[model samples]
Every structure is written in C-alpha cells, then in structure tokens.
Target: MADDQLGEEYTCRVCGFRYDTPTWDGGSGSHDICLCCGTQFGYQDTVLDGVWSVRAKWAAEGHQWSSPEFRPPDWEPGTQLAQVPDRWADASVLAFKLSAPPLPAMRTSADPEAQRAEVLGRFLRDGRLTHFPATGREWTIVLEHIAAGFEPGVKYRRLEIDKLLKAWHGKPADLLSRLTDQGFVANDDQYYWRAER
Candidate 1:
C-alpha cells in the first residue's frame, strides 16, 4: 500500500498534537480521534478513548475545532523505550574509557584521523548523534577524540566517555571493544585505562 494510505506520524491540525493515525479509513469510514485533545473528526469519541482512524486535511483556513487541553494517554507499563538499554551511568557500570592511538602512515600524505573528525563534526551536530549516513570511515572518525582530552591510563567515568564520544553513532561497547582490540585501551576490571608501553 501507499505510505500515506498506511498512515503516518500526524500532528493534529487543530491542537498541534501528534498521533500515529492513517490517512485512509480501512473500509467502513473514518474512526480517528486525537488523544491529545478531545477532538473527534468522523470518529466516535466515546469508545476505547476514541476511534483513531480519521483523515485530516487542510481546510480553506484551518480546522474549525477549538484547541482543547491536551492530555496524552498513558503508555502500557514496560512497553515504552525497552530497547534503549538503560545505558545510564548510575551504579551499574561505574565508568568507561578509550585510549588514544597514534596514526599510522607508511605512504603518501592523508590524515585519516583528521578526515574522520571532519566527517563526525558535519554529521553529529551539537554533540548529539541520533542518526547518520552509513560510511566506511566510522571507526576512524570515532578515534578523533582519542588523544585530544584522554590521558593514557586514566580511569575516566562514563560521563567523561559520553563527552568524548558524544558524536559517535555506534554502541559504547563497540567503541570500547575496538579500542581494546587495537591495543589502545586496556580493560582493568570495569575501568578502561590506556594500554601502557
């Protein structure tokens, strides 16, 4: 089916509320309701909170319904954000770290590390990395912050690691593992210290 027919992440045209409603009614008719505001458009607003299968469109000016006080429905317990992996650095995983590695070059001039840094800066704006285009230079770019602020053998906490790898798009474990495999960082129990010479 068409993407629009399958529904979309729609924002209420009246109250500016968002809902995952389809643009088309299955077979009978529209049954959409805005959970945010009590606005029913071709929907029975009394059943199961409300039938949410109505389509919204642009009126001559806009929607005529007055904006109601938005009340978001409660999610089912344990059904929200279950895949996030609760990576918070509370009392579980005390800290994390990565070691700096020297760039290797046996041929013509080309700073792989610098290139990685530039790419990361372009993709991860403002120290946040929600999504980025896949590229072959991922690990190289992740290595940019290696020697900048990290000191060898220092047991830095997860907060520090978060700052250093704020722009990295991969899981923190993978980044740490890569550094350890490359002999850059050493795993001392739970802390990641720089591998000493």
Candidate 2:
C-alpha cells in the first residue's frame, strides 16, 4: 500500500505520544485514552488545564508508560516527549532525561544561535522554507532570512512584495504579515520596505 493509505498520526497533548487514532477531534474528544500518559481525551483531558494536571501527576510518578503491555520494548520516554507541540510544551517535562543536551560552557566561545540556525536549515529546501518551525525564535530566524532578500531603503509595491515573498514560500501573505508585524519590514498602505537594521 502507498504511504497515503496510512492515516495521520495524532499526538497526545499530555505526553506527546503519537497514536494512530484521534484522541480529540473537531472540538470534541474521541475519549481514546493515551497508552503513555493515561489521559482519557473526553474525560480527564477535556480542558488544557486538566491535561496538564494529568501530565504533572504522570511526571511525579516517574514518567512510566501507562500501558506497559502496549509499550514497545525499546520505548524511550525522552524521545517520545520531544514530539509535544510548542504551544503545549511543558517546562516540567524537561526535568526528565529527554531534555535537550546542555550547551557547551563558555557562552562567548559557543554560538547557540549558530547551532540553532544549523538545525533550522534542515527545514528549508534550496533556500526556500519547507515549513515553519514551532519555536518563536526559530520561526523568527526563518522570517529574517527571507526578509533579507529585500534591499534596505528600497520601497516596494504590494505586488512586488508578494512576488518576492512567493519565491520563498508558496503562500506569502501570512509570511509577509509576520515580516511586517515583527518589524523586519515597515509598510504603509501602498508600499513596504525592509526595516532599517
């Protein structure tokens, strides 16, 4: 069968486990319980606060897989937790061993931004954004890179801006909005220009 034959995998909001079935759907819970964190979508996780409450309890209990029988022999908690969406990424989960590796000491010697750029580069295809990153900083870096194509101090008509952004992304409206909203570009009703650095 083709890859498309496989349905989309949905992530558990509480523990970031990806399951074949939908736990929450169209503003309603499927009530499918997570095998990892034991979150019952329609029951215990009806609200975001409740989801975090369950996650906190699960973490306190050593982050054990709720359904050991369903867990793979090589299941790694840290690796699974990394899939949590940035919107729901819990700092408490970092107390577990799955957190990112510590940065090298000596802040001046180690360039964290460069390291992040290297990782972000993987999401690009031939200098065009393949998709936006979840984290704000990484997302900003991508927008900055795209915005750099515009020459500073040169005003561009809306059509020109659209054409320029289309070269970097298939849908440029949202990207253009973010660029102006974030001060990477300055614009009036009819014209836009790269913001002075």
Candidate 3:
C-alpha cells in the first residue's frame, strides 16, 4: 500500500501499542503510551500523518517545520515504529528540554528609585512588564526599600517629610532648597531626585 493511502495510526515503536484515530480527552495532541513499555508520548500533529512515503521526507518538510528547535527526525523504514529505543528517546527529550530559556536571578535592594529601576529592567528583559499594574506611591515606597537592599515581600511604613521638617524647624527644607539651587536635585513632581539631564 502507498503511504499516502494509510490512515492515522498511533503506533509505539517499543511495545507496539497502537491506536487509530483515537479521540483524546485533552485538546493537546499527545499520544497515550507504548503498548509494551507504557511510556507516554505527549503529542503528535495528526494532519501530517501519511502525508509522505519516506519518513525522512516527512521529518524534513513537516516535523521540523512544526517545531524547528525540538522535533525529532523521522524514523527510517523497517525501523520499529512501535517502541522507541530509550537511548534515542532520551536524546530527543533532552533536545526539547534545552529549547526553553533560563529564568532570571532574584534581585535584592532597599533604595526606592534604584529598586524600581531594577524591577522595571527585569520585567522589560523577561517580557513580563505588562503583568505589573499601574505604578503609584506604594510602588515608589517598595522601590525605595529595594534600593536600600531590603529583601522583597517585606512591608515598611512611608516616611513623613513633614515630621522631619517640624523636628528641624524647617532646616531640612532649607537644605533641599540649597541643593536645588546648586542644580543637584531636579524639582519636577512632588518627589525630588537627581536631575537626569
């Protein structure tokens, strides 16, 4: 029989487990298992089955195209399609494992501005910035603590500048004014920080 005429057959090369056009409970296209070893194959593209006679041609044109980084090459004819050898299967599994990117290292900080920048940089790098909601004074406080090298997931009270100014009889404001005059601090929003330009 020509390969094109063959219908979909889920055959394990190891134990010779076979199923034909089986309805999978999960939407994912994974195979059930090997009849002999009972090892499960996650998923296979159903549309590509029997599209070509030679396994090599199917692998090159279909499998590789479907998953460029992880798909295994097609099995050769006369090769047992039922049960995959452990050694070869292990290599294919390793290839799939290596395809994922590594996770980022945890950050430590206490200063708000520095912490905020670091957190923002991490989110930007990992494409996770969108997960963060809008920024506010609470976020600013968190950033301050992070800049100070405080660990994440800890809470702290917000600083009240008015109390400090009252204790110094307005001396702190005078010093800030001096710094502003010297171009050391840029007064933009209510918060003061070093001038960017």
- Report lDDT per candidate: 0.38, 0.68, 0.34
Q: Residue by residue across 5-116, what tens digits does model 2's lDDT show?
A: 2222366777777654465666776555576787776688656677678878887898886655456666666666666555455776544425544212211215877756
Worst 10 residues of 2 by lDDT: 100-109
Compared with the true structure, what per-residue lDDT tens digits does model 1 show for residues 6-115? 22223232233333343124332223444333345334422322322121221222323222222223322112111111221122112211221221211111686665
Q: Is candidate 1 or candidate 3 better by lDDT?
A: 1
TM-score to native of every candidate shown = 0.31, 0.50, 0.17
Between candidates 2 and 3, the lDDT winner: 2
Task: Tally clashing residue pairs in candidate 3.
Answer: 27
RMSD of each: 21.4, 14.1, 21.8
TM-score, prediction 2: 0.50
Q: Model 2 segments beyond 4 Å from truth? A: 1-13, 16-75, 78-109
How big is the positional error of residue 44 in model 3, measured in Å on the Cα after superposition? 10
Q: What does candidate 3 score in Cα RMSD to the true structure? A: 21.8
The best candidate by lDDT is 2
TM-score ranking from best candidate downward: 2, 1, 3
